[model samples]
Target: MVTRARRNETDPDLGVLAGRLLFAVQNELFTSLAKEGFDDLHPRHGAVLAYLDEGGVRATELARLSGQHKQVVGTMIDELEALGYVERKPDPADRRAKLVCPTARGLAQARAADKIMSAIQERHARRIGRDTFTMFKAALIDVTDHQRRQQPQ
Candidate 1:
């Protein structure tokens, strides 16, 4: 159903809603992970871990994915290194650039987070009807895609 913005409303922007929803999801996942004795991991760390587990990536690429600076990403990588969660390897094409990959322990942690995310999404799906949840996801994806396409070069 189409709805109009309420008069005098202060927050009808989708960006605001997206940020709030992201925070809610992250907060839940963090709480769930913390209970399992993974309190040392952080939200940003989780993002980097997920990215690395998918495959090796340059530090700059990871920074772009995380919307953080390269220096900050490098710092986070160092922390992950200290925790034995990630390690740097030689990049095949660029010897000077390092490829980041998660350690076995990091992969395990990412997999655990995956399960937690699934459970959280399942709970969300149950709260909202299955069809409603599907439509909501599609709507969000459509908006995100459209915004990306509209960005000026």
Candidate 2:
């Protein structure tokens, strides 16, 4: 079972609820750039960037990771490539496959962004307390794990 989420709560002050949620998301994004240095990145780039950060992967694998069509990943890759965030190399494991890896700059940005995100998360943890934050993270992980496991393998 999942812990109670604010989504189910009917807020007496709609403006406050909306503002808080929006502020949190905006703050996190800005915080990411602030700690990482401003970069021309879009949120959609996040899914792909995270995958590349893990390790080099084939284009098709990225498509799977992003839960987007192969063509969509191709488009995203084009953008990342244009931005010098990633480079593609022919996959030696299989002919006719290309693997994407982050550039040095990309790696640096990823590390910085990771720090920023961690800081924002820490702030949230301070607000909710470690026990609540732990439960929240565990619940989120459980939800995602369950959903992913349900996907066709």
* TM-score of each predicted structure versus truth: 0.79, 0.74
Off by over 4 Å in 2: 1-27, 34-36, 149-153
Once fitted onto the true fold, the runs of candidate 1 whose alpha carbons sit more than 4 angstroms away are 1-12, 149-153
The best candidate by TM-score is: 1
Whole-structure CA lDDT of model 1: 0.80
Model 2 Cα lDDT, one tens digit per residue, 7-74: 44643354455457657765677556755655577766766776785457888888887777888888
In model 1, what is the error at residue 105, expressed in angstroms? 1.6
TM-score of 2: 0.74
lDDT of 1 by residue, 1-153 (tens): 334545214546777678778888888888888887678888777557757744678889988776667898899999999988888998889899889987887777788789998998788899998899999989988988787778665
Q: At residue 32, give the lDDT of candidate 1.
A: 84
Clashing pairs in 2: none
Best by lDDT: 1
